[model samples]
Target: MPAGKSQYRKGEYPTFEDYSIYAQRVVLNGEFVQHSHDFDEIVLILSGTGEHLVGQRVYSLKRGDVFVIKGETRHGFRGAENLELVNVMYDPRILLSGEGDLRAVAGFAYLFLVQPAIAQQEEYPYAVFLDEDATETASTLCGFLIRQLEDCAGQYQVAVQYGFKTLAAYLANHYRTREDLSEKLGIFTRAVQYLQYNAARPIKLQEVAEAAAVSQRHLERVFFEVCGLSPMAYLLELRLRHASLLLRGTSKTVAEIAGECGFEDPSYFARVFKRKYGAPPNQCRNAKAL
Candidate 1:
């Protein structure tokens, strides 16, 4: 937080530290030179639609969508007509480690914590306006994080830190970590939430319908349209996906993972696992492929 005098006019000097949170309206056709930041980015689309160009790929974002740009993910946006958003950037360390500066981890964080997929040729998933409960909670958390960072109130640092944990958890839960077919890649965020929460259950089309408050037929039509998969098939794939995550992230036995992922028969679970992942339970667990 260093203060410096501006080149023009009346005596004026300001330190970035004096400003805890930075909020502004980024108008369309605005050219923001490519820049990188040490803190994380939480971008909330207030209205209209826009495209985020990170390198060559263009991510179409719509109103009510909130995107988390982890660290130095080399991102900038172009707003469409009538576009508005709240872009929150805060010292990532303040929200994560709480007490110290992340001078040491800045570079590494940029690679893993910030843009984990950039080098791997993967694109960060876009969390469009979907799922009322999750998106609303995220928006509230983001608002507070930005406020506390901008204000630097008493103990706001600690509060901001905790708020980030909530934000991170929500991101991981709401967005699927995959390419090709992904829940995170869809527009109906509520359906994704329902699929995530009830992935292991014997999912019914009507239930998916009810959870999203859309009729089964309507849900199927749009789910297929946006996701390229039927609602029920999407649910099955999600179960397998959760199981796949457990396969690598934990030491859960096949049977435990099977039941945990809603499959009653371990034998049947192994069959589905092999079919979906091209490997049996033991091999998958051994290889630790998620």
Candidate 2:
């Protein structure tokens, strides 16, 4: 993001600590000039279709798809239609802040983008599939930002912060472990599906363990290691997350959704939900009405 060359209408954002997020609508109807970014970026294709040429490689992109641009990896785009792109440029130091300050992401300097087929555990620079969680957040943030950009409201800055928060929440939760392949690769879809589908059911470690065909102890180890959560804790999160969705999206009563999503007591559900989401179910639901 440099100063005042918005003919790309592509301008740098200000005051973003770790990274900057930008929305570009490409309508040039042809190829773009070759350029590169010094920082790491994860770009989402919000609408339209195009091909990204990085060095000698040509990658096709479509709606609901995303790609990662490694630092200093030469790349450019060619859009045949109205292409909506969301670019998240990050400071590698922030990502390496918690882990050792080694340049692990520097690996991407040669690879360019992480294509979807290999987007599993090997899915370095991961992208999302059309599953419930991925699709919901992808469309929501894209739509929200597009609206803010269109309206140019005085509260646009607040909306922009919120937009980044939603993207952060989505990526922090789903980025590393995304894949659907069962054999040959331990894709995350199976584990997430197991947690969501059986959240309300009698979830014993052995059940998911056997379902995944791995031993109970091994499954427990990976659940925490890979997902950053224990089996039971993840189950609680799934139930609560779904219950929150129901509260916001429907007129359903809290008691009804609590039971539907697996809580036996409405009062206890309210207490736990409040603790997790920072508000009681009724308040969260009513906040929607506001």
Give the best candidate by TM-score. 1
TM-score for each model: 0.46, 0.44
Q: Per-residue lDDT for 1-290 in model 1, tens only?
A: 21121121101212124333343334454334444454455676656666665554566766556555644466666545556676655444333234432223312222223233332233444223435566667667777666656566454645656655555555455542223333432324456566655656677777667766767787778766665788777767767866766675468799999998889899999998899878798897643243
- lDDT agreement with native, every candidate: 0.55, 0.55
* lDDT score for candidate 1 against the true structure: 0.55
TM-score of 1: 0.46
Model 1: lDDT of residue 228? 75
Residue-level error in angstroms, candidate 2, position 20:
29
